[model samples]
Target: MKSTHVLILLGLLAACKSQPKEKETEAPANAPKAEPIACYQYATAADTITLKLVNMGGTVGGALIYKLKEKDMNAGTIKGTLRGDILLADYTFKSEGTQSTRQVAFKKTGNAFIEGYGETTNVNGVEQFKNADSIVYSSSMKLEEIPCK
Candidate 1:
């Protein structure tokens, strides 16, 4: 009788050990998630520029529109990566019934983003910056954060 009780207790211990804990089977309840889409606009008396950005994992994609005075309006989508406070991407736009692709860079400061310009070389029909480190961020073309509509 004593040996049977000891064997039963040992069997119960093995069964309990084999079962997975409840917390181990459950996923984390506070896992981090990606941020929501953000939109910004820069408007003046004669020009209006809009930008919308969506973050997928670590990559960034969005739409950019430029309606400048006395110039053909260019609108397109941008796909790029944000490194630190700088955003480097390629803009494929349509203007004057023609499509063009060009590299674009922007520097983020506070709630605004400044456009960057630099010398570029046309490579295989795509215009790209000769040296990204030499790009100049201009405050005159700053785009402020705006409510997305």
Candidate 2:
């Protein structure tokens, strides 16, 4: 009788040890969540430009569109990194049914972004700034913050 009781107790212990444990079902309280996208636009009587940006820990991606009088509309996506107030990106766009890629830079001031212009050289068909530090941010092309639509 004593042997039988000991065997039953050992079997129960083995069964409990073989059971699977439950996994964690909740995310950590400090995990990062999705960030909101921002949009901006610059418009005049004869020209308009729009930008949408998503920023995640300084990495950015977005869309840009330019519609100028007597010029083919350029629409594209931009992916790049934001350092302080400066944004350096690659603009892959289509204009007049032709696809093109170019490097673009912008300076963020207050709630607006000014497009940067500089001397460029074509490398492997992609236009790249010759001197990024010498690029000029133009106020005339500033895009003001706008509500996303």
lDDT of 1 by residue, 19-127 (tens): 6656675446664344656788899999999999888567788899999999989999998899999999999999989999999998998998899999999999999
Model 1 ranges off by over 4 Å? 1-35
User: What TM-score, computed on C-alpha atoms, does each candidate reach?
Assistant: 0.75, 0.74
The lDDT of each candidate is 0.89, 0.89
On TM-score, the candidate that comes out on top is 1
Clashes of each: 0, 0
Q: List where candidate 2 sits over 4 angstroms from the true fold.
A: 1-34, 56-58
Model 2: per-residue Cα lDDT over 31-117, one tens digit each:
543365689899999999998998754568889999989989999999888888888999999998899999999899999899999
60, model 1: CA deviation in Å? Answer: 0.6
RMSD of each: 8.9, 6.6
